[model samples]
Target chain A: MPATSSKPRLGVFKFASCDGCQLSLLDAEDELLAIAGQVEICFFPEASSRMLPGPYDVALVEGSITTAHDAERIQQVRRDAKFLMTIGACATAGGIQALRNWGNTAEFVRGVYARPEYIRTLEKSTAIADHVRVDFELRGCPVNHHQLVEVLAALVAGRRPRTPGHAVCLDCKRAGTVCITVARGQPCLGPVTQAGCGAICPAYDRGCFGCHGPARQCNCESLVGHLVQLGHDANDLLPLVRNFNGAAPEFRTVSDRLEQGWPEAGGPPPERIPT
Target chain B: MTDTRTVRVEILSRVEGEGALHIETRQGRLERVELQIYEPPRLFESLLRGRPLEETPDITARICGICPVAYQMTAVHALERALGVQITPEIRRLRRLLYCGEWIESHALHIHLLHAPDFLGYDSGLAMAADHPQEVNRGLRLKKHGNQLLEVLGGRAIHPINVAVGGFYRAPRREALQRLIPDFEWGLQAAIEATRWVATLRFPDYCRDYHFVALRHPDEYPFNEGRVASSRGEAIDIDDYERRFAEVHVPHSTALHSETRPDGGCYHVGPLARIALNRDRLLEPARRLADELRFETPCGNPYRSIVARGLELVQAYAEALDILRDYRDFQPHRIPYGHREGTGCAATEAPRGLIFHRYQITADGLIEFAKIVPPTSQNQKQIEDDLRDWLPGVLDRPDAELARRAEELVRNYDPCISCSTHFLKVHRHDH
Candidate 1:
């Protein structure tokens, strides 16, 4: 990756999620000009109208796979990409739209469109890695700008990008903020949530809603007990666990148990292993 | 003289979503024109079922990245109506400011990155930048300012987590807003110049008596709050959006075609519709610039939509400055919403056009049903009409030229096929 040996070719691919993750790249103000100079920017339709054929050096895939065509398309992207990275919660653990995975997708389709015959979609919205091997996955509802920049820079440097996989509680501790759960008895997903959003909810004098998906080794059972103690009922817990990263294994396990009318204090047989 | 070859223009190079222009003519007679949208439908409405009403803003914001704020605003507004809640005046004003940021950012992206290259005869903004580096830089600078505005108010530009159903998760500090005054001043100058520069482009001479529909406010240009109005003497409240304009499902697109109640044809929204309807409400500097440049109000040509977008950018900057001048501290109040059963509809003028959202909430605060008609779908029919009118005049031009112009016309609308969520191509046996 010499600076003078022509710029690295870049391609942006979208699947089933909202266009927010790709929009994050264009939203980069200071780094955009510098990055534009360093990369060929071969294909990014959201920003530029120009495109080029690719055996690309880096392919940043946004969204998840939600259709038959998209399921096939991810394989082609895998073949073309030298290094592929999935950005945002949708591409990582499935987006909030992944709520379809828990219910009847057929009925969901009929509920939305007047003519279901016209709509071509799969039964579930799945992450990109479910189909193809993703070189890296950035976790966030839409992803943090600093992490986005750092990942792109690391890709150029041919190294694993540094993104925090720790719980939001660590960031809250670092920021020296009081615990909303302990002090105000607010049910927060912060203990199980990723830390990229800068503990924004806690900073804003509210509880974290887990837009960044789940952290590694999240204790969903313990978190649920805390939420229950905080005066949250079944109705509150249902939406809480099923947020941006609702489909992630840990969150989904707890949510599914709750939805099936499991006891809050002690669930039956611990509900088929923790995520 | 049957020239049965299909003029397939796969113009997926610019903007959000995937769409292409398919035109078929046999023996010099136009047989079919289809604006095909190939973007996959995510079924936002279906997924919203069973989710809590509070998550509506955060979830719906995912509809379109370019105008996430618009989605947030419309979703929250609808939720408020269903929950029997009313946001404070200060919160409402702040919402307008946030929308202005979206207008500036989205419009700047279209005018500079997508549409400008077509006007300047370049393949892309990168190509255009080779000759007009300063212009490109200024557009970026202005776009940056808009993103900064969102950062201050909503905490981040795309999929902002700060805003919720009733009000913001946290109110922006005055010092944070005050810091943006310098950038606003600079963007104001840059946008004014950009508008003048865009005005210099050669526009296609075309006009139509469109049923121009928009949200009209009494005191200001429409943003988050306004009454729905049309050029054909139709005005109504937000709740009556479904009654006033009906969406008809066309086979050509997954996105529905919207028209006046009586017919399913074409109408206009976005810059031309707004400037046409609210010319008197343009801010002082924008109004002065319009007079200084002799830029006529209510421009009809679709090509001039680029110019109208540029003007809106200037107005957004001016409005942001005015808002910052009178900024107040965060109000201490919980977002008041109660469980109620109702059907709520809202239409906000997104940077592109009228973005309509309709929702039916159950008694227990669950979303029973949802419908969203983005600006791109609304303009799909009108785009086909423009092609019908402009194609005949420019058909004899080089295929490359015709293709380029055709793509430019589509980009002029800044259509987000992802938001529209459905379009298709037809290969007819007759053609």
Candidate 2:
């Protein structure tokens, strides 16, 4: 929706992320100056040092809630903004870091840090929606810059953004690229994955890794069946879907189903599957 | 009167990731200086285990958006080394071209948007844009050219998808590479002017005897391959990286501070280090521009790193142009390879500094173990040391002013707290 005020106050917040989605704002290179002209950039620490007191007109939040501080801090952000949108995989679905949600986070801490006791984090890495209400969720590993600009522009103009909710298969068809799954027998998530990435992986002769989250009304079961037909076992399908957007509800359901009943007899389960 | 004071910055601005600074003084003498990074840990190393080896390039790239190419390059090189896949000369050149795009994009962003505002006495680049519109536009244009180069080669500017273990999944056509030539040529000229422009900034009169460390290659300015070398006469292969350096956990910060072993002394890295060590290897216009700017080696003023970053930007553009000029078909983008169970190590010069990656792969191509040492972690100790030595000189300044200057000093290193902390949580302790 269009802003009530002439120059809408904008704030950008980070929780726990790679800083890619935030960088997309800067990556909007030419449009950045013009965007700054249109809105009041109140709180973007990655881009500016000048910070205005909040109760912002809009807030573009990145990253997932990983720490106790973040869990509490996000509530204050929601209180401060009139409209709050979660950007990228980390915020929309717990990011690739959300892979820890399936395993023991304490073990992950011990494995990576020399002194695990010094690090304080929640047992599960979770999406922003888990802690607070999110107005809209913009999906992508690092969101598409053009889509980011469009979302901001739409919000400023008092209209809904025109981002697509279709699958990567639609974008692949639109681009007239040969399907990697059909030709190379690659285990692709294009049929169920979202389209914002412009079908990039398929265009490059590789399978879609689902950097964009699951598309609206995705038929993941059908796609997994197709992969099985293409000579992939239940085991291969598990890791393929459990990647950047693995923690998303639809992807998680499929991955869990594929991983049911393992470690038969005494032999070790699969060599490469994460516990 | 016995006087004491404390300076604290809750969160630093204009740098990647979350970090803070706290300084304490007792009786007008500096007591402590801490560069605290509180970025939440994502546990990339632990999560990487059990993933397929080929998936590494894409997975590790998520560690930092600003330098995903660095992570991808390091991972691919390490995996290929273990797999015994010898990439073609053409592939090597292509990798260098892709890296050039990253360096150009990263350096331009840092020089203009992040660092320049500090030197110009503006609160932010947006404030500076009101006065220096032309300069800001030029910087953006240069940055856009770099992004364009990445788009053409890697399919996206941030978190590129084209890079694979042996080589790219697919190569760009000659026409695609040619399209960037015009913009790169313009960028090359603009980059030279940027170097000269940054040189004119009034830097504070401060110098330190830094033990600079960076990757050094015999034939070229280091990008993909080199020996780990430092100014204190220490040189070692990439495999010996764990032996010479170690990460120490501090109570104040989530990011582990890296120190040179034995005595646990700090060492400097990044643009300043790269330029100091590999100045002679700079190609054409960058070499001539460096000479004209009088950017002498053994230069220790951290604030002057903006100038070094600009000069490197020039090198990136020149290198990109050179690679495109020698473009060939080189059919079959990537070489075929089989999985092996062995450990492999590789170090590459990220825009910031040297980033090292080591991995042990299983016979089935799964990543059995993974270790990554990003440039920011390696520089964390040096940042604290710089603050300690530099704080004593400015102790008489007001608390707010001291905090501002301390933040600027940290920004000078262009530290990526996101890369360092892997996980960060800010805890404010005022004494």
Candidate 3:
């Protein structure tokens, strides 16, 4: 880590993803003015035309590595920053674009572009950690703005950020939301998905689609069995686990198992379940 | 005087996605002008194949986080059209309200954070905040109100989960919506002041005799449904989009350049097009503000889009307030529909411009094929054309100033390059 200084120099970088995670910083309307007063936003291209040279104090990187140029660019970013954090599903795990990893990338290219030969892309989309060491990883399709603010605040204050590692089920129970799965026989992912989104879907009476990645020690097999009992087959479970955070280790293992004809012996249990 | 020079901006800043501009001049004559979209393709169309049709709304929304609602709205509208499902009036109103939230959020962002810096002689909005804190604060608050609206109706602000194929999983309570009224009221005033403020900025004296295109509805300003119409007296059904408009691949850029099929010419889309096409349909405060700002119809200057976006922000707030005030309890949250094998197409007014989606599904509700045409791809050719036309006036200026001006030209469209490269619709040429 770089030596501590009076005001932390912040850097925001992007690779191959939607510009949403960085946008969350701007989306924090009230908090942004206060935050801007504290940190030197040295290199955020999406918000400013001016760029400051970096040996940045804290680097928040977004997007997955999907091209040869970006694959090399991320290493340089890592070398320049003292504390590097990966934000959103695209950076922590491959985003929805990672669905191409299982299939043929050439065919995938041909399906979208009229001139596939002109397009340059990697065969698979992988996260920033696959290429570099990450200090912390924040999860979400587009990360929660409040959590993003918390992380930045912690960095400025020289304290550990307080982010929960529990399942969406905990948030649902706390919010007193009727479990869509038990109450209406809907196939919900709340038991396996992470909780940063405040259990919004369950409160809205819909199944959690797992925008956040898998929670700590998520029991996806038991949840799959529950979904199957709710009349959904392996075909349904495959898409659910393989969505935004599909390429994440836990979620990918479950999805791959379902695709391989649902073996009686599934993958190993998660390392630790949230108490 | 004969001269040779190359002006290149390797990484154009303050835009949605990664892109660059390369211009080469020989003896004051423009030799090459290429707007290079280096954003890697995401292959959304290929991923849609074999997936259930119900998943389209959620899957496609990931195309661009800045405008996920646009992607979700277009997908559901097309899918509903295919399934022969007509949503209830209440559901329609709610969808419109959701769109208003997006417009406010997106427009406020562009006006204050992205585009405003160019006029203010600042490198970024953060830099400008030092001198104009009050204006910046107002813009942020306006944007916050928009986010609040999205959270109330759709769930979370970015990539909302409440929207599905037929309709929302659950409609918001009237009381919940009413809670947002005071903020919306403040937002309307802020947007109006924003329009007035931008009107004072010095716009370059440049206008192009171009084709302006957008979705035109018979009743209200088009948001979800309308006929694909252009200013050159050409109007066609949304189904004829593929035949009338086509995207061609250029060697230098990953994003395909779009054009009108018959003449192979470029057309302008987005805020300027929307306001020019449907000016009369704008509601009270926005209409009155536009009048005070002296916004004449057929605004051909691309730089004035800031004013147009600000006016739309005001209109969006007014429309949202109207919907919320008239909202009633006990409205059905969603209308159920069964899926069948068919083709459907729809075009909606995204904050940037018109976004169209077409899908063909199999008998069991599997997506056979999908095509998404975002606003940025449609504006790509127009941006290059603008550069070609506007370069002559500033050819003698310093390269840095010229390049900065070129970036501002591109920002006028507020291009979202991520949305453009997600679906390319590559055509196979049989040898």
Candidate 4:
């Protein structure tokens, strides 16, 4: 019945990260069937066996481009979809696996696998946008499922989805969560991190780990400087600033300086952090 | 004419991660089988190097979205072992409650959405949902209750952030957990009925011999801790896991295939294996459900695994209710610890199967090395072995039908290919 339907076709694809982001759509248990009714889920192998050849209406790509094969495959995905959206930190900023970009990828494979020769991977894990033009990018280590629903609905309605670009501090302020960085002297990146994940870490009585990459106009260096003045070590700042969004421009620029020398002043952040 | 044929499933659907199957037959003889996992490797073990020990739970939880609690629980246990730490009894109960939440979520998803379609002759659960709205909605509702438990206790469902090396970063208040009792009380019955509903589906007569393996604990159905036990009669301490099992890289897949050490043979994990090994330890209601279904111990049919997963759903829901109803918040939410350079290993029963983890940490709490043997990797070789045995029986069917049957057999494992370095995409070659 879905084959003959003219509903906007949605294709979900993955590359080099955990399947969490795509699962967010499924995790939206209340809205999944309703969304499926509106969007003909024509090409998500994770959910359906039917794999219709696509000139799809919407394509949601998860994970980073980390293999030679994936590097080429994404070009086809971009060509097939009218609107392509990258979901999760891996798609937008290379995810936690971006940690490998700092060192030797060959060594990384060798460290994990006994037969490194059997493994074939690129020198770096990079975001989907590095290889193809993306219409939208949803940021999170796993992404907020509620935002995912909003985006799917927006794309169908031909409207811009209202995703917050401000820092998570805004969310904490709205929720009235006490500041862990101030109240408990905990190292926090909420001031510089994006507003997703509903600002849960502080309410859990721990410092923010920055699951949702860098916020719009993130002042990463300024926040790091404040923490350093508060007696947190270089180690603390490096881990906080260079985490799931470690490869995002603001965080990466600040981390690169911290790697060179933190607590001591460094030069300005670069205009961009290339994937 | 002597028939020669080949079938390739280019992308396997209804499972986590990317994988495909390649099958070959020459003159009526099954020649080759490959459960190829093409999901790009993320290098989690290598990336974990030099990270703080406390971060292990959060970091390792990224291995699979469907089973992140398995990774988190295994990581925290292993990290605690490395640090020579002891968690309070209250914290231990909380960890079990968290795991129960995951089992409910992961298993409910697999049993109803991922695995049930095969029995009902549908391409997807959404397709099945068209005629079975009540059933599908009930399943998703049950799954959400699990997510709620995770949200209240572990901070969120996917990659829960509350788990730490010694214990939770914050113990959930008694009231927070108590609120879940009503839902869990309802879910326990829902899961029990769900098990009965799934048990009615006509299962193929596909019983075959298996060296079933899972964790075995004395007091309970194994979750957080246990000896690695096998239906083949091998039981060893979790520390001796590597001595018994080892992983090897194959040319066709990014996920490494694991084999029993020395013997170098495939072994099974997941619900079927776990049930075979630990049926006696299941809670009273679940054990009774198992008996009511007339499911004997060591059920060797892979197709009936949907029922097996249903049984565990009942077990998880019932156990979670017990914990939530008796909930209490405690002091020292995290145990303080001193670390000396040390190594540790732990095994926990994920919703899918038994997952093993080992780590070496520096005196300063930075991880020196980490090894995670997710359940799917342990079952990869076993799935391949099953296909070799299963393909012959379906050879009389048309090429497309054969491939569909083959894919159903693979799906019976509820394989979490994402966790393995891990689906079936099919091409048919005839000669």
Tens-digit lDDT track of model 1 for A176-231:
98988878878788999988888877877778888888888888777776566556
Candidate 4 lDDT, A1-275, residue by residue in tens: 63578789999998887899998998999999999889888898888888888899999999998899999999999999999999999999999889999989999999887888888898888988888999998989889999999999998788889999999888998999998887877888888889979998988888888899888888887887777667778775786677788998888988887877675556543323211
DockQ by candidate, in order: 0.62, 0.73, 0.78, 0.73
Candidate order by decreasing DockQ: 3, 4, 2, 1
Q: What stretches of model 2 exceed 4 Å from their correct place?
A: A1-5, A261-275, B1-4, B423-431
Give model 2's docking category.
Answer: medium
TM-score of each: 0.94, 0.96, 0.96, 0.97
Encode model 3's per-residue lDDT on B195-251: one tens digit a residue: 899999999888888799999988898899888889997788899888989988887
Superposed by TM-score, candidate 2 places the C-alpha of residue A68 at a distance from the truth, in angstroms, of: 0.7
- Please give the RMSD to the true structure for each candidate, in Å: 2.9, 3.9, 4.2, 2.8
| Poorest stretch of ten by lDDT in candidate 4 chain A | A266-275
lDDT of each: 0.80, 0.87, 0.87, 0.87
Residue pairs clashing, model 1: B253-B423, B254-B422, B254-B423, B255-B422
Q: Is candidate 1 or candidate 3 better by TM-score?
A: 3
The TM-score of predicted model 1 comes to 0.94
lDDT of 4 by residue, B1-431 (tens): 45856666788889999988877677777777888888888899998898888778888888899999999989888888888899988889899999999999998888878889888998888889998888888899999998999999988889888988888888899998888898988899999988999999999987888999999998989999989998776699998899889898888888988999899999999999989999999999999999999997889999889889999999999889888888766798899999789999999999878899999999898999999999988899989999888877877888788878888999988888889982355554444
- TM accuracy, model 4: 0.97
For residue B379, what is the lDDT in candidate 2?
90
